[model samples]
Structure formats: C-alpha cells, structure tokens
Target chain A: MTDRYKYMEDLLNRFFSGETSNEEERELYRFFAGEDIPAHLRRYKPVFSYFESGLEKELNLLTGEPAEAAEPFRRAMPKRRIRIAAGMAALALILSVAALLFLRKANAFDPYEGSYIVRSGVRITDTSLIRPEIEATIQKALQQEERANRLLLSLSASNPETRIEQIQRRINRQNEEIINRFPNEMKESIRRIIENK
Target chain B: MKTRHLIAAAILLITGSLSANLPAQETLKALVKKCESMDNVNTSVVRNRNKQTKKLEKEIISLNFSNNQALVNEFIAAFEKDKLMADKEIEGKNNGKKTLFYRFGDTSYSFSQLNEGSASVSVIQKDEYEYEE
Candidate 1:
C-alpha cells in the first residue's frame, strides 16, 4: 500500500490503452497478489483483482484449459453470469414492446358512425318507447281539433252566406288531422297545389 | 209522363257527377299498389326521417307525425315529383274560413324535429338524401 498510488496510475494508464489484452491484464493482477511485492505496490493490488473477474472463466470454457489450473474449480463462472444478464435484458425488451403495443390499441376509437342523438325537445335513440307526456300532448291536440270542427259545423247550420268560410274551416281542420295522421301524404298534396299555380 | 222524366233526369245527373270525379279517388289505391311493388320506391331511404313517420315513393318526401309531413310531402311530390293526389291535407293556421298552409319549404329547407317547432339546419349526409324524382 506504500507506493500504491504511483503503481495504480501506471497500471490504469496501461489498462485504458490498447496495450493489455485480457491475458496480460490477469498476469498483472497475479503479480500484484504476490505477498513479496514491494510495499509501494501492495496497496495497488486490490485494483488489479477486478481484472480476475472478467478474464479466464469465459476463455477457459472455449479453450478447455482451466481444469488443470485449479483442482476444485467450480467451472466457467463468468460465462454463466454473462448469459444470465443477457437473457434478463432480452426479456425486459420484449415486455416493453408488448406493453407499448397494448396501450396504442386501447386508445384507438372508431370514428365512422354515431349512436343516439337528442336535440331540442325531441330525443331519439335506438330503443322504441313512447313517453306518457307525449300521449298527454296528443290528447290535448285531439281535444282542440274536436272543438274547432264543432264550431265550424254549428256556424254552417246558422247561415248560408258563411258556407265558403265553413268549407274553408272544415278543410283546414281536416288538413290538420291529415297532416298529423299521415304527414307525408298531406305534404305532397300541398306541394302539388303550389307547383300547379 | 212527367214523373217518369223526372226520375230519368235524376239518374243522368248522378251518372254525370260520378263520371266526372270518381277517377281521382280511385287513383290513390293504384298509386299505393304501384308504390308497394315498384323497385324505385325505397323504404330504406325514408327510414332516415327522424321523428317523422313516412311512406314515400321515389319522388315524395312525406312529412310524418312529427308535424313536418304535409310540408315534406308538398315540397317533394308537388314540387319535385310533380304528381298530385286529389285528397291532400296540411297543418296550417285558420285565416278566416280557409286553413291556409304556411309550412312552405323547398329543397333547401331543413326537415328537423325539435321540442319547440324550430328546425336546425344540417347538411344532409350523402347517400342519406335520395330523390328518385
């Protein structure tokens, strides 16, 4: 640990440059691990031990050479760790892509047609149910028509001069009923009259 | 001799009146038959009539219970179709003895249903607006 700072700088400079391959790096670490190393370099030994972690395991698996290096070797430790890390990264990438696709589909909407629409007093929708209020309204209309018709009939009985007025009144009331009952037909007839003129 | 002549004259008068106008009344049934069978009269086209119930031919736009029937029909059949039914009715106001129809509309008119009798204009969807006439 004495001259550890100077040796570490030298090793670091050599480490960063393209000068040391994995074998050379391991040899440097082994040299630092030796007990007889100068006190100056002993403190620097721990830094180079990091090199032992990455090197011989994967290379020994490929070359079939590490079996003789240690008698009770656990075998190719670094290669297994690298494989496990790579598999985890791949799985995470697949899940992220799947989640992104699911979110995009969930937000998509159909823009072509529409559902029910309500406007002003009239509300229209898919279901066919008539309201009680509408029935009451229709009843009021019928009552009015009945009164108008009765008035015109009585007036007709009273005098002959008002016959045309009576005819017009009767026609008007009938017209209302016709339009109310069968609007489409009545409308067509009126249109015909106008066009003829 | 005078009694016999009176009876004959009455019969002749009835026959003349019947001959003069009976065809008009009969024409509606014929038109109905024609409409029922004719491929040109599409029920699907009139199905878009909201709040209005309709039975129309190619040229007609029947306004229906929704209070637009008379106006719709008159606008379409009378103006557009140029065909007339002898018996036609419209919802209108009482002016003196005549019930004058003020519900006038042209092709540009809006056929809409509202709570009050106010119509909001809309650009009809394509293919939704069909006129055989």
Candidate 2:
C-alpha cells in the first residue's frame, strides 16, 4: 500500500507538470474513483473526477450519444447569429431614418420662403409685417393691368366704327324728336336746313 | 451578406443624392430672387390662400423701380421673345405709357413704363385657369 501511494504521488506530480502520458492519467482517474485513497491525497480527487466526467461526455458525443457536449456550441452559435442580425437591422433603421429626413428637407417646396421687400434703400424681409403691403401692391398692379386691358379693348379696330354708328343713330333720333315738337310747317324747313338740302 | 447590405445602403444614398441634384428651371420665383439683390429696386410678394382649406392657391409678385429705364428695357428685351398677349407701345391717353402683357401656362406677367420714368413688373401665378377662346 505504501508503495502504491508513493507511485500515485509521483504520477500526480507528473500530471501537474504536464509530463504524464494518457495511460498514466487514466490510471490516476481510476485511482481517484475508488474510496481507498489516503487522507492526505483525497483533496485532489474532485479535480480528477471533473476531468473524467468531461472526457466521458466528449466520448459520448463522438459516439453519437445524447449528452451535454453540444449544449455550449448550440447556445453560442445562435447568440452570435442574433448579434449579427440585430446589428444589421439597427444599421438599416438608422439609414432609413436619415434618408427620410434628408429627402423631406430637400423636397419641401416653398417658393416664397425668401420673399422680401425693398423700399427707399431699405430691405424688409419679415413676411408677417410686409404681407399686407405686398397684397396691396399686387391689388394695385392688377387694377392697373385691368384698366390697361379695358383701354386696349376700347381702342381695338372694330370698336370705334360701332361706337360711331351708335352715336349717329342717337343723334338722328334726337333730331327727329325735336322736329316733331316744333310747328308743323317749320318742321320741314328745319329738316331741309339740317340736311343741307 | 454584409457586402450586399453595404451595397444596398450605398445605392439608396446615391439615389437620394441624384434626386436632389435635379435641375431647376428659371421661373418668376427665380427672377424675384435676382431682384432682391438688385439696387434701387422694390420687390413684393403675396401668397393667396383658399379660405376654406387655408392652403396656398396663388402667388403675386410685384417689382417697382424709379428712374430705372435700363432695367425696364432689360425686362422688355427679355420678355419680347415670349408670347405677348398685348403690346401697347404708346398710350396717348395716358401720357405715352408703354405696357406689355404676357401669359404662359397658369402665370401672367405685365411690364409697364409710366410717364414719370418709373417701371413696374407684376407676376401672377395660379394653380390653374379656365381656357379662354
């Protein structure tokens, strides 16, 4: 028994130094699995037991047995995939929002935003204060244009001839009324004189 | 996959920039901007709104310049190429005032030179107009 303990101690030292072979490591595991370990060396049993359980799980996975060997890998792969997907989604969302704001600002069409008024070497750009003056100026301009249009219509080629004819008819009608009001004998004389007969 | 996402983002940015880079034509609004920077000129603009909807329906721009025959002539020369609806060179009844009127699309422009060496230009823009014979 003392010889066995001495050998076990030597194997433990080699394992710590990473010089023990696989067979010797397996033997240490088997020794720790038994309850006959000396009290002084029993403190190292848990470490060998943990390594033995881990190796068994790895072997079970290699043999296609259902075990915890694939749990860490399964959990790790999805977490990485989710992180990548989330990053892309956030990037797309930021780009979309920025584009929307830029387009809206670029396309907002207000032609009169920079309208202003200059008077007597002074410039007035406040829309609210100058709006009434602007409206009045427009009204005056429209009125002036309307007057010009009316004048042009009156001066058109066909208007003066029609006006002359209407005026001639009215004058003849007035002369006839005046003759009828005069004495019957004098009416003929007056008509002859007016016609320059 | 990452390269594809980056390419799509680049395409979207390029499209947006291209749309923003479209050329703008010369309009009355552009003329108003020019007039704003000119010396000895008075410029005014009025936006007409619909009473019911409270939305902008039309715009009116007016410019007045005193003793600025050069500017008046410049405007006359520029507008002469456009379709003129009325051209009264000399109105003897109104002290020889010259008036020119032009209509294009839904906009109308009038340029007038008064006897006192004052020139006025008026622009009226509407959403639409009824067709006249």
Candidate 3:
C-alpha cells in the first residue's frame, strides 16, 4: 500500500478510538477529498465526501436561499410548543379559581365550621356554650350595679328612680360593650336573644 | 301525746319539702369538695383576669378521678340533681366521646366518663364585670 493510504488508515483508527486531533482529522479529510482512490479504499470514500459537503455549506450561506427556506420550519416548532405551554397555564389558573370559589361557597353555608373566638376569648364552634357565658357576663354586671345601687341609696339622699335610671344606663352601656367584643357568630346569637326578648 | 306526734310529723314534712327544694349550687360544691379530697383525684382551678378590662374573666374548676368509680358515681348522682334543675342540658361530643353539659343561667358544668373508670368534670364560670378593688 502507499504511504498516503497507510497514513489514512492510522487516522481512521485514531478517529474510531476518539484519539484523533483536529489537525490530524483535517489532514485525513483533505487527503480523502482528492480523487483517484485505490479499489481497497473505496469503502471509506463516503465519509470524506460527507465532510466535503459540510465544508461547502459556507457557499450555500453566501447564496442565502436554502437556509432561509429551512428557517421557517425550524422557528415554527418552538412557537407551537410555546402556545401549548400557555394554554396549559391558563387551564391550571381557571381550575384553581373554580376550586377556590367552590370552597368559599361551601364555607358560607356553615360559617362556623372552623373555630372562632367568643366574647370570653375562648375558641369554640358551639354557640350554646357561648350563650351561658354571655348571660353570666350580664348577670355579673347587674350584680355589681346592684351593689352600687345599694351604696348609692345608703350614701345619697337622692330620688330612687334617678339613681336607678343612672344604674340602668351604665348596665346598658356595659352590655353593649360586651356584645360588641364577641365574634360574629356569638353576636348573631345575642342579637337573636335580644329580638326574642 | 297524740298531738305531740302530729306536730313532729308536720315539722318533718316541712323540713323534707324544704330540703327537696334545696338549691343545686350547694350540692355541686359539696360534691366537688368531696371528690377533690379523695385519693387519686386531681383537682385544679384556674382564675384569669383581663388586664385591659379589669374584669375577672374566667374561673374554671376541673377535676379528674382515675380508677375511682365509687367517687365518680357519687359525684354523678349529686350532679344529676343540678342537671334536673338546669334550664337545659345540651348533649355534646368531645374527642368522639359523649359529653353531658348542664347549663345554669350564668355557669356551665360539663362531665365526661372515660374508659377504665376515669372521669372528668369541668365547671366554667365566666363573667365580665369590673369591680372596685
């Protein structure tokens, strides 16, 4: 065999083994790109021909025709992927909003399904427990006012009705303050109690 | 002698009726005291005052009797009297167990009988009134 063919065989072995340097591969490509090959080396001609065609793509870029035609199809793939991604995001947002609205509507029917504070600052779902506590608050306020009334009667020689009216006003003020301190559910229950009375 | 016997019978009748109408407050307090003094009975009372409002906000008494069914039965019987006089006894569930609640005008008492002869009672008295110190 010729020394040129022996050199090509060494380069092909290096290339297959991934040990060929860029300069050595380029030397191989240049040697094979020239015509007049031996019959034994004909099988390797297609590989070097592929390299020659790749190098000739610079000429195609100078013409700027075929690359432009391939550009639209390459760009269309990314645009289609973007549209599909945007549609999935919008669907997820719609589903989240629908779930939130459904949960809010369900909670509105039983507003106290979760725990909330009563006037006594105790968190409980049962309003029956709160009713007795509210009554206790009012009764204690009345009892204190009654003690004050007794003192007022003994200490001051004022009219009983005037002192009683003042005590009643004080009690009313205290009761209003207490009811306002309660949470919404307890306030509703107290309002119902007052309306019934 | 016959007149004396009649007078004694009338006196006994009056006292019996009066005892029949005895207020539940006295009985409940007595039962709580008795249970608190027994062995293996844990009694605790928590008193809280609201600083801003200057009110005695809460007074809660809790009692736990462990392996003391006899004391629990006595206390239950005594509390049954109060339950009879309560305006309403609201049945409730706590931790998947039945709870009997007796609500007076201003105070509420809840009782639960647990497994293994353990029982608990809680007396909650909450009031919002600012008293002179």
Q: How does each model score on TM-score?
A: 0.21, 0.40, 0.31
lDDT, candidate 1, at A168: 66
Measured by DockQ, the strongest candidate is 2
Q: In candidate 3, what are the lDDT values of residues A1-197, reduced to their tens digit?
A: 58878878888888879899989988877777777677777777787777667545656778774744677899999999999999999999999999999999755442112222222222344534444543443454345334433544454444334556656644443343334444768766554443334
lDDT of 2: 0.67
Candidate 2 C-alpha lDDT tens digits along A1-197: 99999999999999999999999999999999999999999999998997889777788889998777588899999999999999999999999999999999757544345556777657887777786786687678678657645655666544444656646654554444444444688778656645545
Candidate 2 ranges with C-alpha deviation above 4 Å: A1-115, A120-123, A148-197, B1-33, B84-94
Per-residue lDDT over A1-197 for candidate 1, one digit per residue giving the tens place of the 0 to 100 score: 54665565576578768677777676677776677676655666766664465445667768987634854454567677889999999999999999999888655422111222233324343322323323332343335434534544564456433557546654444333333232465566543432332
TM, chain A, every candidate:
0.25, 0.35, 0.30
RMSD (Cα, Å) for all candidates, in order, is 18.6, 22.5, 22.8
lDDT of 2 by residue, B40-129 (tens): 787777776665555677777788888877776666665553322121321332456767665544566777786465888887777775
Candidates sorted on DockQ, descending: 2, 1, 3
Give model 3's DockQ, 2 decimals.
0.02
Proportion of true inter-chain contacts also present in candidate 1: 0.00
* Model 2: lDDT of residue A106: 59
Ranking according to TM-score, highest score first = 2, 3, 1
